[model samples]
Target chain A: MAQNQSAPDATRRSERSRRAIYDAALALVAEVGYPKTTIEGIASRAGVGKQTIYRWWSSKADVLLEAFLDLSGQAAEAAAQDRPSADASPYGIPDTGDLAADLKHVLRATVDELRDPAFEAPSRALAAEGVVNEELGRRFVATLLEPQLQLYVDRLRSAQEAGDVRPDLDPRIALELFVSPLAQRWLQYTGPITYEYTDTLVDYALNGLAPR
Target chain B: MAQNQSAPDATRRSERSRRAIYDAALALVAEVGYPKTTIEGIASRAGVGKQTIYRWWSSKADVLLEAFLDLSGQAAEAAAQDRPSADASPYGIPDTGDLAADLKHVLRATVDELRDPAFEAPSRALAAEGVVNEELGRRFVATLLEPQLQLYVDRLRSAQEAGDVRPDLDPRIALELFVSPLAQRWLQYTGPITYEYTDTLVDYALNGLAPR
Candidate 1:
């Protein structure tokens, strides 16, 4: 019956299973933490066979990483749904000729995403694990976090080229002034995250704190 | 014999036991994490009675918090020992009237402290737990992180008065522009932490990312 199925039917079924697996993985990690999340558990929760998970992902880490990436994509897509260019990649920030507005917009969306309960619990669990587990932490950063940070880097680079940013400063470090503050506040509960806070961050970052 | 002991002798014995308990609590948290590390465990490892720990700190959280504070104090003391005035408060940053230099000096010391193995392991463990545990995270920030940040706030306030910083800016948020970057790097393994990196953070934060 499987062999006789149409390719489109098979594709639809595969997509469904992948989504289910991702959901299961996120839920399991949120409830049980990373070290205890197993492929078998994910498979059971996903209503798929263990071989189905094994065929796709070699380890639980792989499954979780992909699941997180998928989740991030969904968050980004939701955030960008109202943008002017619907076909534009959700992974990149909008270049609206105004660095401050663009950054604030992205950060505000990040604030929303960070607060969403569906994202928060699993993200906190994974992030908590990453804090102590250096090897996994690096992998998580490399795979999930860095690419997102790179969006800021890319935006800053564009700002540099447009004369909106200081040409001499490193874009990588420059991006951190706004991004890391929000991240720390979110990760450590150091402060509140709000659109106002993020907007202020952009203002402070764009204008020198030493009396213009 | 207990009643025969002089005041100073009894104080010395108590201090020794307190130090031992702090060390044990830190070590246990580093090894077994926040949930698994217990009051009995710290007492056993420290070679002190469980009642002794209970007499001072009510829970493992209390013990770990004090341990971290003590460790931070030691780090600051070691970092500031080269100062001209030996009596200067170790918790406060140096104010040579140059805000940038003073900040660089403090941040560089922080770089050294974050890299210290004794502080690094236990701090990471607690930080990891705090990420997932909101109540603990807030407590950690309020007790451990906020006080350290207040040092920066104090420094920034002084700088504002001296016309070195914009008086309108909030010192608490302004400090995060530099501090949170180093924190994020250390916590998430997103980037390398070094004296040079922190120095750059201070520079970028004060000058703003946009052109002068």
Candidate 2:
């Protein structure tokens, strides 16, 4: 019984330390951005030794990636709470069988996430770093961005099966019609993102801009 | 006659200095990126005084913007040489009455531009700055990006009048389907770009991503 209790306590302690580390890493990255954020800074701010961070993660990039992943999970949980189904994750695009509606829903949620202060600062920092660092840019795209984009691919594939999307269309490129526009607007500050704007993108994408 | 010849000589010298300044600004931005690129640095590298840059432009961003504008004009002129029609701009999207083909052609040119080593470095530098800095970001979008995007808007508007595009579709948002995807991929390293990829994007945008 004592061993079992000690195991749980240890797990709880580990969880606490992990959360603290994540918080520190996110805060430091937001404040100073990726170029200046260091392992030592995160460890110091988290009240953990730098060795402790090294024991768990190889680099600041690793720590930040994990932190961002955790943040995404948390955002999903927050998003899930609003939906009727308890089992659904808010992390992926909704497949409510209406492709346009589902896409619009996901894109709007993305807009909200982009606007959220909790998500914005660290995201901006990582994004700014990605702009200058090719290796990190590719790695982040592969790990974070590609997976999220794959959700769209999956949705588009489902649409293809249902005969909702063109059979000849590449799901990857097709998804970008509605998706990348929002991303470019957000990432590049090219335009305002209203629910109206995203909704309009869905409509324009679904009907050829040419007379259908 | 001698005075007229001397005036032409002065003009040529000034033009040479201006070109040198533009080259230096582009090189500095590529080397150090936007935030670190300084007017003094551009001046030293151009072999011109800081006052010379100040006389022409108020800030490094101004100088860089003009440099990009000049570069874009040069690229357009180079592209123009390959065109069959004497009347058509090599820089302008061909209005061949087939909206899809015209869009694909222009996007393919953009794919080449995005991939070009000469264009990539400084373009990336300005784009990276646009991601984090709102003032410069907005200005770059307005001055440089919006103008290029507007050209697409113009072409789309023409397509609309020709009954090629839906009368109801907003050309501005409609253009985003093909345009923003390429922009996002280039800015974020989201994916590899190719003529095939751009062709696919044009096809997807021209037809509803949904089954026609």
Candidate 3:
């Protein structure tokens, strides 16, 4: 009975330590960038032993990836809470049977997330490092970015089944039509990222620039 | 006669030094990246005094920007040489009356340029720095990227005049439908960049994703 009672307490303590480590990892990466951020630095910042971090994560990259995943997951959950009846599946884009409206809705949420200070700094730091580090860039895309992009693919495929999107179009590339522009704007600050801008992107992407 | 002859020699010498400096700057930036690349390093590599670089340019950023400009100009000239009678005008996209054809042609050329070894490394280095550095990012876009985007705007406007494109659409946003996807793929390693990929982007942008 004593051992069993201690197990639950230990699990709760481990969970708290994990959250603290993730927070430290993100904050350090945001402030110092990927190259300068270290596992030791994260442990020191989190007030945990370096051994504790090593037990949970293999490297700084591993810690950072998990940190970002947690951050995005929290953001998604918060967003879902805002729209109670919305598809709240953290892994999927909502399909409300209105392709354009659904895309615009998701994109607008993305704009909000991109603008959030907690999300923006570390994301920019990691993205900047990814730009030059081909290996890291590919890893980031595969681990963090590709999963999100696949959500768009699933949404597009559904749209195709409903005859909202052309069956012949590659969903992967088709999604880039609306997605990349907003991403470029946020990543490069190439333009203002607003709901209106994303709405226009969805409209122009669904309907060709060429006259009908 | 002696002074006049010496003046021409001096001009030729200056031009050679300018080319060497540009080459050195690009190579240094590519190797060490933007943060570590310095005016002294560029001058040393170019076999010129540091004073010579500062005499002509204000900072490392200034020298790097001009170096990129010169490299792109050379790339454009080489691309033009391949298509003897093509637009060849570095400042404009060809308006061949078929909006789809013209856009596809330009994007294919862009794919070639982005894939060029000489262009890719230094461009990626600079672009990587720009991602985290907001001031530099804005300057890079304004100086290097925005000018290229404007050519598309000009082409789209001409298409609008011809009634090939919708008159109500904003050319700026419309251009992003094709351009940003290519940029994101190239910058982020999100996917393979091919002539076929760019061709698809042009098609998807000009013809709606939805059925005709």
Candidate 4:
């Protein structure tokens, strides 16, 4: 009975330490950027030993990737909770039989998230590093970004089956029409991101910029 | 005779120093990135006095911006010389009556420019800095990027006037359908950039993704 009680207490302690490490990693990355962000700094900030960080994650990159993944998962969950549907998957786009509406809805949520202070600073720092560091960029894309992009691919494939999108359209490339515009605006400050802007992107992408 | 002889020599020396400075600035930015690149470094690398750089350009940002502008101008001039027309503006897109063909041709050339090692490294460094620094990003966009995007707006406007594009579409936003995809791929390594990829983007952007 004492061993069982000790197991639960130890599990709770580990979970608390994990959360603290994630917070520290994110804060350090945001403050100092990717290059200056170190495993030692994260450990010091989290009030844990350097060995504690190594025990859980091998590198600063690994710590950051997991922290970001956790943060994004929480954001998706929060967004899901805000919706009317009880069955919405946190990472999935709504397939409400209207491809344009669904895309616009998800994109609008993205606009809000991009503006959020919690998400913006660290994401910009990591993304800025990725632009110059090809190895890290590929890893970030493969692990974090690609999974999110695949969600759109899945949605587009379903749209193809439902006759909402062109059957011959490569879902991967087709999704870039609306998605890439918003990304460029956020990443490059090329333009403002608003619901109206995203809505226009959907309309132009679906109807074509050329006369239909 | 003495003054006339020295005038041409002085002009030639000034021109050589300017080119050397530009080359040095670009190389330093490419090697060490923006934040670490300094006037002293550029001066030392160019074999010129710090005062010489200050005599012409106000800051390192100014020096780098002008260097990039000069490099881009030379590249644009080379591209213009390759074209069939003697009248093509280096900064302007070709306005063949067939809009799709013209846009594809230019984007293909852009793909070539993007792959150039001399262009890629310095551009990536500057762009990465711009991602994190909004002030510099805005200035970079205004000076270097927006002017290029304006060329697209001009072409699209012409397409609209000729009844090739929808009369109601905003040209600025409309151009992003194709342009932003290429930008995102190049900036993020999200996908492979090829003539085929850019060509397909043009087709999808011009034609609706929905079944006609």
Question: By lDDT, who's the top model here?
Answer: 4
Cα lDDT tens digits for candidate 2, B1-212: 99989999989988998999999999999998887899999999999999988988998989999999999999888877766684345667788787888888788888888888889999988987777787888998898889889889889888889988888888888888999998888877888888988888887788777766
Q: Compute each candidate's TM-score over C-alphas.
A: 0.95, 0.94, 0.97, 0.98
Query: A112-187 in candidate 1: lDDT tens per residue?
Result: 8899999999999999999989888999999999999888888899899999998998988888999999999999
Q: For every candidate, give the share of true A-B contacts it also has.
A: 0.87, 0.81, 0.89, 0.78
Q: What is the DockQ of each candidate?
A: 0.87, 0.76, 0.88, 0.86
- lDDT (10s digit) by residue, model 2, range A1-212: 99989999989988998999999999999888787899999999999999989989999999999999899888878877776673235666777778888888878888899999888988887887787788888887887789989988888888889988888887888888888999888888888988999999998888767665
What TM-score, to 2 decimals, does candidate 4 have?
Answer: 0.98
Best by TM-score: 4
Off-target runs (Cα >4 Å) in candidate 4 are: A86-88
Model 2 TM-score relative to the real fold? 0.94
Residue-pair clashes per candidate: 0, 4, 0, 0
Off by over 4 Å in 2: A1-7, A86-90, B1-6, B86-90
**How well is each residue in B17-78 modelled by candidate 4, as lDDT tens digits?**
99999999999999999999999999999999999999999999999999999999999998
lDDT, candidate 3, B1-212, per-residue tens: 99989999999999999999999999999999998999999999999999999889999999999889888888777767766375636546776678888889889999989988999999999998898899999988998889889989989999999999999999999999999999999989999999899999999998989998
Instruction: Indicate the worst ten consecutive residues by lDDT in candidate 1 chain B.
Output: B82-91
Q: What lDDT does candidate 4 reach at residue B168?
A: 95
Residue B48 error for model 4, in Å? Answer: 0.5
Comparing 2 and 4 on TM-score, the stronger one: 4
Chain B, TM-score, each prediction? Answer: 0.94, 0.95, 0.96, 0.98
2 or 3, greater by TM-score: 3
